[model samples]
Target: MKLVNIHTLIFILLFIIIGLNTAQAQVWSLQQCIDTAQVHNKNLQMNRNNISIGEQKEKEAKANLIPKITVNADYKYFSNLPYQLMPLSTFNPTAPVGQYKEAQFGVPHNINANLQLSMSLYNPQVYGAIQTTKIASELTELQYLKTEEQIFFEISNLYYNAQILHNQLAFIDSNLINAERLLKNMQLLNEQLLAKGTDVSKVKLQIAQLTNQKESISSKYEQVLNALKFAMGVSIEQKTQIDPNIQFKRANEYTSSTILDIRIIKTQNRLLSSELSTLNKSRFFPSLNIIGIYGTTGFGYDKQPNDFLKFFPIGFAGIQLSYPLFNGTVTQRKINQKQFELQNSELQFGLLTEQNNMQVENAKLQRMVAKKAVETTTEQIELAKTIYEQTVLQQKQGTASLTDVLLADNALREAQQTYLSAVIDYLKADLELKKLTGNISTTK
Candidate 1:
């Protein structure tokens, strides 16, 4: 019985060890996470498919200007009927006794195989369509680029979030260790009668609170890890750790106000203008295309050897001319519609540029202010630490109370937490500024 129990314990221990190893194997770097998300994100894939669809539309528009051909087969049967070109006594002589027939014909089949060509000889709409489709294709390509930008933005933010959580967890662990040490020191003081029962109880209570805090933080860390896995397109069963040491480097690169602030919107505005130009040109000229046709036809009405044995090949060539004179003001309405769209696009572009400028300004200001806050908070943490140590020594000499020491310790902890959080905010904001400047991916 003792051997069985030992074996069972050993099995459980080995299982836990193996599980930890398996979890560690799934850790992903930031770049790997971004690449994985790009591959698996459904929205990005949908945008990619739109690009292909645009290309297909361009191809279809070009194909419309090409000639088309077809083949046809038809069969017909006729019953008794009055004959116009036959003699009056040409009734069927082989008819039954009481039956009379004016004319009779067997089943006849007509076959027509024609390679017909119909090209746009004079159609402004098709001509405009090809150019518009090309522009549309370009627009789709831009949309793809826009999607990539958004994905990178999301990945950057999420990756930073995971790092923040890891840092928080580390802070919590450090606090836990400090609290446990304090508890042991309080136990020694109590045995020596240097501290009262209330002091010991206070230290124990602090330790318990810290332990609870650690548990709470561990739970939150697990939640953040799950979110990170989702962002990385990994399974929930995977566990991973992020490198908190990866810091954003400040650069004297070109300011966002100078460039990269409005280029994206500018690209869209240009594409829209291109569309308007195409629409305006559609009203003036007609498209031109050459059409060719070659085929054979058979009437099959006659069983003559000449008709049945010969393939009736016929060919015809012609040019089609079409001019849109007027339609209940359709062309005028279309032109007005396009003009309105162009106006709206211009307005939207202006608004976007303004927003981008505002974002650049705000990011710059926040970055500067956050940098100062980090510096101030670092000093505050150090001062708080010193004050807490002095308060503890004074309490040991009976000159300070438990409340003063507890207050001082709490202040130090708060200061430390604030300083750590400030650092994270500053770094994350810096990265965001870089993203707004369109340099998120430049840092390898």
Candidate 2:
């Protein structure tokens, strides 16, 4: 039985270890990173929360049309009864017309309780507020979409940067291998006194330099990964890996008349216009409200407590009408101020449109330049590789010098690096173009 128990424990431990390894091996693709960021990013979540608040405000505006009910209760005790004046001629015929008598009346304690209900029957302001809140809600939704687009762009850029660094590291590794092979061959030649020791030393130095570059690139790759994790709202302490396969391709042309920012601004302007209109209508039109109250009043005297308290029921309902006749031209001045705001909104929209056009044009030009650079560098790398290979063969045949081989190798490395840079630039420019044209959100 003890042996069986030990075996079971071992199996459990093995299972747990395997599970941890699997968890740590999880990899995220570009799409997954963007999707995760949309859900987990703090700023996006806050913007979504604002949409919820806007929805609540809309509900509140609708609720204003419903009746409101309230209950109130009060208790009062008068140490001294209130006084009243009456003409004295009622009791005495000889009393002068101006003569009067003073007397105190009413109970020493009183209690009142009431329930009141009120509702707006006809208020233009309330209607206008409903419209305004609806537009505001739409604006919140647009804001969230805008934030989502921004996150997508940011994640794409970070992913591209990481892939570029990975490519650079691979390039360095390949060069290092070639350098080591050359160094070994030079050493063999040195043993036979056919090659100088300095040649071998130069190749060794080249290998060391490549190794240092690889280390630097590796560190940069890790930093990029950390940044990606931060953007995805993942825990920095957790081990996360991104898919290393990245491809660069030209994006389809996009032409949008309006971007997300423009839409949001227009919605804001509509809300403002609604507000101004409501203000104007309110100043000219009257508002109507219905009010009703039901309650009982109680009266009692401490000296006549045995008589008990008496209660009287009362109730009343009425409609009220209010109109703003004049307020020192305040309403007109407010309308003018709102009109100015609307004009400013329009001006801002025009300015933003011009800026967006410029961005799109600039990104297109940049992408074109980068594409050309990539093509040129790709050819350069091929030619440099051919030259390097031929130089190595000639060196073995006692024709080419060591300097020719080293220069060719360096040229090849430079070409590879230039190609990598061009690729990254093209990717960034494409992303920028997508963003400017409002295609980032729709493009996967």
C-alpha-based local distance difference test score of model 1: 0.70
Best by lDDT: 2
How far does residue 40 in candidate 2 sit from its true spot (Å)?
Answer: 2.0
Number of the top-ranking candidate, with TM-score as the measure: 2
For each candidate, what TM-score against the reference? Answer: 0.78, 0.91
**282-302, model 1: which lDDT tens digit per residue?**
555555666666777665544
Model 2 lDDT, full chain set: 0.90
Off by over 4 Å in 1: 1-27, 72-111, 121-123, 246-253, 257-264, 300-312
The TM-score obtained by model 2 is 0.91
Runs in model 2 deviating more than 4 A are: 1-25, 88-94, 99-101, 304-308, 327-333
Give per-residue lDDT, candidate 1, residue 383.
Answer: 98
